[model samples]
Target: MAIFRKPGRSGQPKPTPEPTPGQVAEELAELVEELEEPTAGGPADGGPSRQVVEYEAEYRAERGRRRGATLVASIAKLIGAGSRSAAKGAAYGGRAMADQLMQAAPRIPVRNLATLRAQHPTAADADRLAALLITGASRASAALGAGVGAAAMLPVPPAMAVEIAAETLAVAAVEIKLIAELHEVYGVRAQGNVTQRASAYVAAWANRRGIDPTLLVKPAGLAAMALGAEVRQQVRKRLTRSTLRRLPSLIPLMVGAGIGATVNRRDTRKVGRQVRDDLRSRRPAAAAYWSAAAPALPGETAP
Candidate 1:
């Protein structure tokens, strides 16, 4: 398919350049913003508040449907490439996926305490906001999983791979954003440049725990430097496990839909609860949250 190729001077296909980190960050930020924000009328309008998170999830799923053909073509090309690289061993795919995830981790847009309070003025305390965030994220993750599973019914079975990949990244983005925001709510916000703090959250996501205050101050923490080999390996293993867990959702027909949604919701809630519990224990006194947590300024990022 033409979608799988780009013409070159000699009529050979050429690869497209990867997006810059800035571009990826912008894209992810926009996506999360859409998912997190309330409906146009807001809660004050007294409109039909059909689950806002579910509505947003369906929006993304609709977009995925429109791109279904492209997804199939892209996966076709990916599978072909995989066949050619079989000699390199199975670890290659895991490693490459991990690298893409790591590249993405540092770019997730995280709001600080100031932004959270401003956006959610009605929430009087950190715990209140944290509860809302966890519930919304869990529902969103379930919706995304259901959407992907439903897509499996399409004639293009191979496209399940692409669907799974997209779902993984999207769900990860949602959860990582949740973890970062929870930290903000609890007043244990990680200290660093945009990339550094984000990297710490990524580590937290992989580890299935909140950021350790001691680690953030330590020179050996993942936040102290760019993602190292060991950290990347940890991420790879975590992602590998995550991807495998979604494999059952590839079953044809609508059976996968129920399976996918259930698994995703359960996993997301588990992570949220784990991180929330950790943060609750470590959070500083309520009075210190505002003074200690700095606002995340516009266009802030690591060099």
Candidate 2:
């Protein structure tokens, strides 16, 4: 696939060149302008420490405003982008999506866990950082969903499913980044080189849990090995199911933007909460450790 290739130079997964952090900063600036607001999340570099206390509030409030726009503006956005997308899309096939995930896995940005801790220096720092990444991912998926949702509304041949598949790959990048970074915050590192770690995190994201250490035990030349059909199959199944779950966004009714936005938001939040809980279950003292650092997260108000 275009995004991944065979390992280079005697057998190490050649690290994907990092997209300039400036690119992320610029895109985020535009997103904030388009929505007239803010949100937060993990680094594009894949570390778990970030400052997201403020953006979460804005995203939580965006649903109601988008609900009001569902009848006109949101629909307008979807249809307008269809023609351009149609030119690039192909006939959607199951294998197409599976291939996309395989390609996307290695591109997920993940920072070294030890480095992430050294940079932040506290357990609570990780939680606050994970919050930003989690919320940032939620917003990123919603934006992709909106565009795909829009493309689907147009009577553009088989382009709708094709567009959906493309955006599925994009959202997978965002979520995979979140999942891998979350592992750092919980102090459980997925073992391996670049592509190997991405594969393990892809499985965790699809399986919707903390990284299974057992999956990380591959030895010697295994780091450069391609992911087996079993891993690819699980990712394919998860992506297809997640895409189908967004169908409610197609309803031209009151639920329009609200449904997709709400579902994506709630679901990502659930993934964050669940994974954190599961990891904490393994290290019951994690929360207590962070709790001692700060009673509440920055910008996390009294509830």
- RMSD, every candidate, angstroms: 6.5, 12.7
| Leading candidate by TM-score | 1
Error of 1 at 180 (Å): 1.3
- Give the alpha carbon lDDT tens digit for every residue of 79-172 in model 1: 3324443333233356766766667777777777777766666667777878777766776677667766776785335445655765666577
TM-score of 1: 0.70
For every model shown, what is its TM-score relative to the native structure? Answer: 0.70, 0.60
Worst 10 residues of 2 by lDDT: 68-77
lDDT of 2 at 281: 57
Flag regions of model 1 displaced more than 4 Å.
1-31, 35-92, 154-156, 218-220, 223-225, 290-303
Model 2: residue 145 alpha-carbon error in angstroms: 2.1
**Against the true structure, candidate 1 has what lDDT?**
0.67
